[model samples]
Target: MRQMRERLGTPRAAGVAGVLFALLMAAAIILVRLALPGGADGTEITVDAGQRGAVQTALELLPFAGISFLWFMGALREQAGAGEDRFVSTVFLGSGLVFVAMLFGCGAAAGTVLDDGQPPSAFGRHYAYTLLTTYGLRMAAVFVFTASTIGRRLGVWPRPLILLGYAVGLVLLVVGADMPWSELVFPGWALIVSLHILKGHRPTDHPSPTTP
Candidate 1:
């Protein structure tokens, strides 16, 4: 029974973690996007008091979001069980780790701008933005691709969800750098996957038999 509980609990825990990761990541991204200037060139990054506060809040949330993402990844792998394909799992784990690292790197770069007590240099601002929206999200795209592949192979995710995952991955890969809000797709995908897992685990009620 102890082992049974552990077996049953792990996936649920992962689902919860995935949900948390999605929420936190989305919040952080939204806050940062709101705080930053709209231009792509990053030459005019003047932060007002409100923007400063928003950016600081986003930075504070990012580390916790990264941690939760790691938990989500682990739980997902565990859900894959022992028969998971080594190549796909390797790619999944590697991409996930790289994505988190890049996320923290972006946060650190942004924090440095905040710490400098002056407007960020255009180069620094562009560097951080590129790290996040370009390279980091591309890693996330790889993660999505590999994860969806594994899910499809294992019959874990439904066809529609798998197709959506593929679409999200493609967006991240091809259009994320050019698109302003494409980063949200990652957390959105995570939310969908998490909710699906939770829904799947819900206990079903049986109808009573009629008397003869």
Candidate 2:
């Protein structure tokens, strides 16, 4: 009974964590975009007082976002229980961690711009830019892919959600960086999935483990 209760409770916890992660991450991304328009070509944008404040705010939000994401990811893995495939879990865990590391690295590099109360140099922009756009999205794509596969095979998620995950993964892998405002898609998907889980995630009823 305790095990079953814990199992049932995981969805709500994961949902809350996911929602927090999604909101914080989306806010930080939006703030960063507003603060640094034109990607690395943001000398003018950086100089603007309003944009500078936006960047500062984003920096503050990132740590909390990372923490929440870890919680969300952990709860999600917990939902899979002990019988989850080691290989799939490995990929899922690796990709999620990499994505978080990239996010933190990006935040650290971007913080340098506010150090001297001046516009960021090209050096800082390199880390802030590529870490966020280049590698981060790639890792996100991998995470999405593995997550969708596991959910589909386990019957933890519905068909439409799994399909959407694949689509989101494709977008993030292919043109996430080049496409404007595409970063928001990840958090958006997270929010949707989290809500679904919270609404009625019945893992015990899946029957996948018992099927002959």
Q: lDDT winner among the candidates?
A: 2
Clashing pairs in 1: none
Local distance difference test, each candidate? 0.83, 0.85
The per-residue C-alpha lDDT of model 1 at residue 210 equals 24
Q: Model 1: which ten-residue window has the lowest total lDDT? A: 202-211
For model 1, the stretches where C-alpha displacement exceeds 4 angstroms are 1-9, 201-212
Candidate 2: tens digits of C-alpha lDDT, residues 41-88:
554534566777888999999999999989988888887776578999
Best by TM-score: 2
lDDT of model 2 at position 2: 46
lDDT of 2: 0.85
lDDT of 1 by residue, 21-108 (tens): 9999999999888778573475556777788788899999999999999999998887666548899999999999999999999888
Angstrom error of the Cα, residue 193, model 1: value is 0.4
